[model samples]
Target: MAEDLSAEIGPDRSLLLVDDDEAFVKRLAKAMEKRGFLPETAESVAAGKAIAQSRPPAYAVVDLRLEDGNGLDVVEALRERRPDCRIVVLTGYGAIATAVAAVKIGATDYLSKPADANEVTNALLSRGELLPEPPENPMSADRVRWEHIQRVYEMCDRNVSETARRLNMHRRTLQRILAKRSPK
Candidate 1:
C-alpha cells in the first residue's frame, strides 16, 4: 500500500540546513528556496539546535560532521522537539555504521555527499518509502577505501598515528593519503 507520507510531514515549507561548509550550505539553501521551501541555515550543531528549538522546521538537511560537534545531535534535538519533522543526514564520509546510527536516531534518510538538490528533495518528501538505490556506477574501490580510512581517522579523533595503527598501515603512507583530497 502507498503510505500517506504527506500527512506525517505536514504542509509546512520550512527547512533547516545545517552544515559547516559555507558554499555547500548556501547552494543548498538557495536550491531549497527555489523548491518553495523557507530555508534557514546554520553552520554548527549549536546553531542548528538554536534554530530548531526557536521554531522547529518542517524538514532538515544535516551534515554528519559539523564544526561544533556531530550533526546527530541536531537530529536528536529535532526528533525530540518535532517528532514529525523529516530529516535527511548528509555526510561526505559515508559508512555503514554511521548510516545505521543515523536512522536509529530518527533521521528519515542518510545520503552521501555530492547528493544534489533533487536527491535531497526526494528524500525529504518520500519518508517511509524504500530508500533510493545506490548509484549504478558508485564510488570506485579506491575511493571507497579512502572514505573508510577517513571515517576511521575521524572516529579516532583525527589522530593519524592511531588511525594508522588501527588500519595496520604505515604512518607516513596514511598521512600521504590523508593529505590528498578525496577521490570522485
Candidate 2:
C-alpha cells in the first residue's frame, strides 16, 4: 500500500524515525524500508532535530518522549522545515492532552505504542478524509487498566505511594499490580 503512495511521491521516500527505544527503532526502520521507504534513525530529540534541520524527510515517526527532550520539539522542527511532511506521533503513555497537542502542532496522527508495522504504514498512507478501521482485537479492559496503571507508575517516578495517591488506589494494591505481569 505504501509502495503505491511512495511511487506517487517520487523517489525521495525519505522517512525519519526518532525513538529512544533502540530496538524498536531498528525494527521499525527495517520494516519501513521493506515497504518502500528510505529510513533514517535517531535515538534522541536533539539528533532528530539536527536531521530535520539539515534534511527534512517526507515522512516521519517520532516517539513522544526521548532521553534528551520532548519529541514535540522534533515535530516542530520537521513542520518548520517540511510543511507537507506526514508525521505520526507514537507514545507508550498516550493521553488526550498530548494527542491534542500533537495534532495542533502538525502531527498527522497519534498512535499508541506497540502499533504494528502494518498499522503504522496504514496511518502514514491513509488519507485524512477517511476514518481508520477499528482495531480487529481491541485491548481487554484488564489490559487497558494495566497499561494505565503502568503509565501512572512511570509518571510518578516509580514511587508506588505517589502513583497510588494520584490514581486513587491503595498503595499495596498498586504494588501487587505492579509486581504482576501485564495482562494480554
Candidate 3:
C-alpha cells in the first residue's frame, strides 16, 4: 500500500465500512482514518444501506456475507444510489463463490479475510484504476453454473443419478448440459 494514498484522496473522501464483525470494523475504520478518509461503520446490510442512501460515501468496503443479508444486495443498492462510488467486497475463507457473485453484481474488488492493513489500503488506493468500469472475469455465469454442478457431481461421487437428484434436475438434462459444455 502506498503511504501517500491518504494525501492523494484527501480528507474529504468519505468511506463506508460495512461488516458484521465488530472488532474487524473498528480496526479497519481506524486504519482508513489514518489514511485521511472519513470512515463510517455499519454492522448490517440494512444499516449500511440506510447510511449509503442518506450520505452516499465516496467509497465502500463491504463484507461478502452479512448477518442480515448477502453483501451483493448492499453492492447493488450502493451502485443504484451512488454510481460513482467504488465498492470493495471482503470475503472469508472459501467464500470465492460469493465474492465472484459480488464482483459480477458490481463490487470493485474482492479481498479474502484476515487481509492485512496494507492489503486493505492497497485495495482502496487501487480503486482509482480498478473501478468506474467493471473488471473482466473469465469465469462466465455458465461456467459458474457448471462448476457448481461439478461440485455436486463430485459430492455424489460421480453418481449421475444422485447428482441430478441433488440438483433437482433430470439425469438426461444434466447429461445434456454437461455434454454441451464439454470440449469436442
Which residue pairs clash within candidate 3?
none
- In angstroms, the error of model 2 at 140 is 11
Give lDDT: candidate 3, residue 155: 61
Candidate 1, residues 23-84, lDDT tens digits: the string is 99999988777777779999999999998888999899999888788899999999999998
Show where candidate 3 strays beyond 4 Å. 1-4, 127-184
- The whole-model lDDT of each prediction reads 0.85, 0.86, 0.76
Q: How many backbone clashes does candidate 1 have?
A: 0
TM-score of 1: 0.72
Error of 3 at 176 (Å): 28
* Clash pairs (backbone) in predicted model 1: none
lDDT of 1 at 112: 91
Candidate 2 has an lDDT of 0.86
Tell me the tens digit of each residue's lDDT in model 2 across 2-111: 34456644567999999999999999998898888889999999999999999999999999888887899999999999999999999876755567778989999999
User: Which window of 10 residues has the lowest lDDT sum in candidate 2?
Assistant: 1-10
Worst 10 residues of 3 by lDDT: 91-100
